[model samples]
Target: MSAPLLQVNGLVKRFGGLVAVNGVDFSVAQGEIVGLLGPNGSGKTTVINLISGALPPTAGSVALQGQALTGLPAFRVARAGVARTFQLVRVLGSMDCVENVQAGLAFGTQNLPQRASRAQALKLLERVGMADFAHTTASELTYINQKRLELARALALRPRLLLLDEWLSGLNPSELVDGIALLRSLREEGITMLMVEHVMEAIRALCDRCVIMNAGSRIADGPPAAALAEPAVVRAYLGDDDA
Candidate 1:
């Protein structure tokens, strides 16, 4: 009934003569977890970059709750209540885990006082299962732990929209279960998310709907099972060796 939380219309990106994203359009509703599924080089990440202001769109518009966001810098996007994790998890390697999260809180949408920020950082680390390693140097953390820490830092931004770029990339089976639970909890707390994931099981378990892309275009958009079953989607992403 209300306007969607995020709207992207005719979005395009070009690097010289190559059009990385071509007239892609999608909308994410409040409290929805929408999965972006595509084969490699289908421009999924480019779409995320455009939406998050990491890359400027060559055409079209991006808006959050009717507030225009296209062409704004990445930091401005973050301050506009959008937070994202990278395909490669990034952290302040020299700093302790809690301190890394503290930095996110200090410079986020709603900056907090030093003491309050530290307390909040600890709470966030706890939520991400990193509280036990609060004092560990970030560079020393295992890859999976680094992913959790990155998530905590993103949460510190206090964002209404979270863009997750392959957050489920390197988890074991047990870790996958825990990760799914954490995501469900965030959903319960009302964080709208746009996730780029290759893992079909996670998509089926977590997504209310999915948008399937190929060659810089959207070929299917609907419930995960239905969209994934589309003949075109199968050819684009899910066929046997050859569709």
Candidate 2:
């Protein structure tokens, strides 16, 4: 097998007395969608932030294709082909959907010309199923549409790796189905993803593997079926009657 697309080794993050993420190690292969699963405060988000350079790790390293990214700032990480969406969707509220995506295209890995950026942004919006809302101001979008807009903006980065934080959190049944379909399409295009998601059905449908965490440490790393079935995972996340 080829080397993993992303490698994180002995990753650690501490905020004062709190060890938010303990020595986590995982690797994601090219084009694979890996689920980062855990209950609340399991440090899943902290792990994501550390990998993406939103927060520097207290110790250890993160590398992509053997290139170190551990201590780089967030913009440096983005320029290195890592793009992420937040748990709480973030967009330029005053800008129209298309313009919001344009900002990404302008400052993303590859800087595009203004006209080309505009056109490409529209295509990205189309990819996320938000083309019809291109002219709408971001503040006008509903919660799900805001999520789609965030996806479009992230895609504008033309990333090799995508980090999605609870992208499926608030969808109704229909929207959830559509969201799943959208993610599958991205996977088909060979986009690698490490998703921090609570939706079990989405995890089962989309993740080729899962890494489960608890109390800031990794507890299980394997296929979702086997990992989710682990007694420790059940006790930590799925709720054990014995506890």
Candidate 3:
């Protein structure tokens, strides 16, 4: 069999005396949507940071398609075909929707020219259901629209691996439905994703497999139902009595 598209081996992170992530290991295959699930402070986001080059790992390694990505700066990682969205929506605020995505296109791996970048940015905005808001300043958008805008920017990178850090949180039921559908569509378009999310509904709907973390370490990895049902996962989310 061919190798996985992304390989993370023995990943570790430290902040002073705190071990935010400990020897966490997982992989994302080509054209797969894998959910990274855990309770608050379970080190899910830390793992994302480690992989995305937002934070250098204290140990272990990250490789993309056999190319070592460990120790690269975040920009280098992006140029290497990895893009990510933050848990807190990040946008150019000063720039309008189209320009925000255009920024991504310009800096992304493709680095399209001015006219082409704008054209591609608009298409991406439309894909994320923000066509009408193409000229709207990012700061003026509602929370959900900002999320959409962030996603559009990430797509501008034309990444092989997309890391979504709670990109679907804070949505109502209706918005959640739309969010899940949008992600499913992206998966169909062949974007491999590793998402850190607490939304069980989206996890079950979008993930082919899940890697569950607890207190900075991986406790389970398997299909959503099977992984989430693991005794250790259950205990991590619920106390011993509940487990």
Candidate whose lDDT is highest: 3
Q: How do the predictions measure up, each by TM-score?
A: 0.97, 0.98, 0.98
TM-score of 1: 0.97
For model 3, what is the alpha-carbon lDDT of residue 198?
88
- Angstrom error of the Cα, residue 117, model 2: value is 0.7
lDDT of the structure predicted as candidate 1: 0.93
Q: Which 10 successive residues of model 1 have the least lDDT summed?
A: 234-243
Q: Top TM-score: which candidate number? A: 3
- Local distance difference test, per candidate? 0.93, 0.93, 0.94
lDDT string for model 2 (6-38, tens) is 999999999999999999999999999999999
Ranking by lDDT: 3, 2, 1
Better of 1 and 2 by lDDT: 2
Q: What residue pairs are clashing in model 1?
A: none
Model 3: per-residue lDDT, tens digit, 1-243?
Answer: 889999999999999999999998999999999999999999999988988999999999999999999999999999899999999999999899999999888877665778888899999999999999999999999999999999999999999999999999999999999999999999888899999998999999999999999999999999999999999999999989999
